[model samples]
Target: MDAYKLMTIAAIGFFVFALDKNQKKFPAPIILIAAGMFLAVFPYFSSMELTKEFIFHWILPALLFTSAYQFPQDQLKRKAAIIVTLGTVCIAITAVMLGFALYAAGQLLVGVSLAGAMLISSLLIPTDPVTVVSILTQGNDKHHLAETIEGESLLNDGTSVVIFSLFSGYYFGSQSLHIGTFILDFFYTALGGAIVGLLISWFVAKGIHKITFHVYQVWLTILLAYGSFYIGEALGVSGVIATVVSGLLLAKELTNKEEEEEKELRRDLKNFWGIMEPFLLSIVFVFIGIESIDFIQMDGLLFVIIGFLLSVIVRGIVLLATIKSVKPWRKSYTNGDITLVTWGGIKGTMSLALLLSITGQSGGSDDGLLSWAFMMIMLSLIVQSLTFYPLKEKLGD
Candidate 1:
């Protein structure tokens, strides 16, 4: 909220935009994060902090809505089973497996509690598809693999958050874990959120149809995006799911409508969101970079390395299972597709937001967990994202 901080971020955004215009191959996010790191170490900006409210309440809703709105509905229908499997079942599998693994590691090496280990595992479970989607869709070639990744990422954030709440509640002794209760809670939140999103989008689409002014239509679209999220949250459901469903529903309705005004409204909405997406993404990556300094101070390099490897292994196993169990009607996927999905399970803003949410409950021993989470995020963004392009070229044949 500081003026100087705002100016610095604006400057970084402009620099990234310029690079994007001229240096076609250079990844803008990488540069933004690197710039954030530079600023984080510099005395003037070193103290700048990324708050949970700013990220979750302000930036994330827009990003999530835009990503979901842009997702191809036809492709999503084809890959829905795979996306749901990875988003829900796979997340639960990874959380439990990784939780026990981290518990063992913590017990023998790091002195972290089992409950704490589970909480950390829950935090790391959600994958951020932003970097992976960008890398995969950089060219004209549209593949099912990209759609699957994007769909899973869109849906999994809400699931992971619900799971995290369960783990956090148990860890903090606020609630006991009951399997029946967990299942009920999960379905209620996820399904309720979807319903809320659908209803809001339906109403918003109707309103937009009546609007005579293009500007008002555009603003209405934006309102639907954020409104679905906030309304869902207020009603005690998953806001992420609400926002995603709303965006997708709105997009589908607009696409199916044949009216000229509806078509014009769709075009304007797409242009508006397209412009906002990069600006918001740049800010996120830069904040990630600047916040890396805290991650460094937390310092659990050995644990983080082990945890990252464990995450990769778990994701690979899940992908293999998905490949084997895919129904006959679904499109057959190659080993390359499985490998890409496994490695492409990147963690970003959602994980950070979850981590920050529990900072108050960590009892001053969460630094190592934070470090591990941070390292995993960085590895996903840098190493996995950069390598996937070449890997795709070699294996995607």
Candidate 2:
């Protein structure tokens, strides 16, 4: 099957799924992912192999830019202290915990090597919950929890990417890892991407305000998003950060003006983003399923169990630590708030992207890793994402 044909089928399914309300029993991402895995398992279609070029060049840009464009600046700033602190420190702490947990778990039961365990741990660390959250939480009462979770996930995605790069470099022949280098890598990658994003967002917002033609203005935002990621990466920074920062900047820069001109602009922006979001999301899940076909054959059942347990333990430890930090704010955190944050860290497309990006001998030995990563991601999104509401209600009760 041709790539275009596969995409066409996915697009058609996505459209049909979107139209039916009763069939909306499951989120589109979940459906697309399930469809992808089915396609991979059966011969409904040929495997949709996701190449490095596809992930690095196209999908990453789409994912990041979309993230940048839709990010909520006010909410992010409102919880800025919590977001930054948890996003950065919490991710690092989780990564370390994941590494040790995997190592310890393997030692106790399965007995995998340190590098293999760490590799699996590193791949699952970046939480991608934007798509999951949008589908799960469709109301205002859960807004605060959603905001913090989304904000932290966005930031942690970057942090995890940076950590993965450091460990990968060490694993390969890039350079020996050191504290100074890690700090430098994180600083430049995240900060540089954000600065570039802000700069581009400022100009793009101004350009949008000036343009009478909505189409042109929308294209400008799209161009800026794709362009900023490459530019940030070229400058030795984190493309993930650049994309997010750009989104953050756009959120801050664009006001919800009801004037005719502003309203038109808002409508155009909304339509443009709206069209892109689901489509990108659909493609992401399809890609995951397509890629999973190649991976499912490579590993055994134990890998999946180890991967799933490692992910849960690491996530549990991270949330437990976060709760401890907010111990002082226990009165304000409310039992509900803490529980929501703990449960809302659902992983999705971002994990798939990173897993798909890995290649050659380093990842070759760990062929089962991607399959495990996908399984863990599905488990997190399904179990944690849905249960949070009940958990919230219980806490409130």
Best by lDDT: 1
State residue 47's C-alpha deviation in candidate 2, in Å. 3.0
Q: Looking at candidate 1, what is the lDDT of residue 132? A: 69
Q: For each candidate, how many residue pairs have backbone atoms clashing (under 3 Å)?
A: 0, 2
Query: Model 1 off-target regions past 4 Å?
Result: 21-26, 139-142, 329-331
lDDT of all predictions, in order shown?
Answer: 0.81, 0.68
Candidate 2 residue 244 C-alpha distance from true site, Å: 1.1
C-alpha RMSD in Å of predicted model 1 compared with the true structure: 2.2
- Whole-model lDDT, model 2: 0.68
**Poorly placed runs, candidate 2 (over 4 Å):** 1-4, 16-25, 41-44, 108-110, 256-258, 297-300, 327-329, 368-371, 381-397
Clashing residue pairs, backbone N/CA/C < 3 A, model 2: 68-247, 189-238
lDDT of 1 by residue, 77-122 (tens): 7778777888888888878888888888767766778887888888
